[model samples]
Target: MSATTAGGEVVVRNAQGLHLRPATEFAKLAMATGCRVQVRTDAGDANGASVLELAMLGITQGVTLRITAEGPSAGDAVRRLIQLVESGFVV
Candidate 1:
């Protein structure tokens, strides 16, 4: 078996953007997927499991982000995360 790489783009829809709470949520989910995940904006990228790194990206609302993951679960991980961001980080 080989690890695969996959990604998806989503606009930050939460009113407050990827703040500590949402960033924490995103990080937790990313970690749960057991993938080498990354999230990026036009300006910079961050490790998906690091809330601090995600916050440093300054992901304001409406900022488009590309999330990539490399692992056995890459594709599903990308889809799962994209849904979270698209839903305004509801859960």
Candidate 2:
């Protein structure tokens, strides 16, 4: 398991932050990468790659989340995920 440090901060723009649907989608994307990802927020920390943990964060619209990805594809994963979040997780 190769590891690297990747980080970014994104604001929740989707009127609902990462709720069930967005979180699920985000999780699915993370899973596709087969890398370990984690997210941190003022509310708490979550397994960035897990839909369940991400949903549990209860992130609300306008909230800012600090995301980090570390694993074989850490750089790519972090970049894409940040883009996802910035794009309102549309992808």
Candidate 3:
């Protein structure tokens, strides 16, 4: 895939933050994006396709996360992921 990339930042709004369930949801969406996704926080960064890594971030409410994606559909991936985060991981 080409180096197409997109990035954005979003704050955790869910009272529980990015827990296992949310991470699972996130990872699934990320994998469906057809792009490689990376999520960065003050704690660390994690592969967006990995639920364990994302949950391990221990992100709590109010934490701001930087999300970046590379490969085809990066822009759409970033936008949709940001929207998901903004929705507090609601389906």
Question: Highest lDDT, which number?
Answer: 3
Compute the lDDT of residue 33 as modeled in candidate 1: 92
Q: Which stretches of candidate 3 lie over 4 Å from their true place?
A: 1-3
TM-score of each: 0.95, 0.88, 0.95
Whole-structure CA lDDT of model 3: 0.93
lDDT by residue (tens digit), candidate 1, 35-60? 99999899798999999999999889
Q: How do the residues 1-91 of candidate 2 rate in per-residue lDDT, one tens digit apiece? A: 6677777788889898888999988888778777777889988999876888988889999998887876776788878887888888786
Q: Candidate 3 has what TM-score?
A: 0.95
Each model's lDDT comes to 0.93, 0.82, 0.93
- TM-score: the better of candidates 2 and 3: 3
Candidate 3 per-residue C-alpha lDDT over 30-90 given as tens digits, one digit per residue, 9 for 90 to 100: 9999899999999999999999999888999999989999989798899999999899898
lDDT of 2 at 53: 90
Model 2 ranges with Cα > 4 A deviation: none
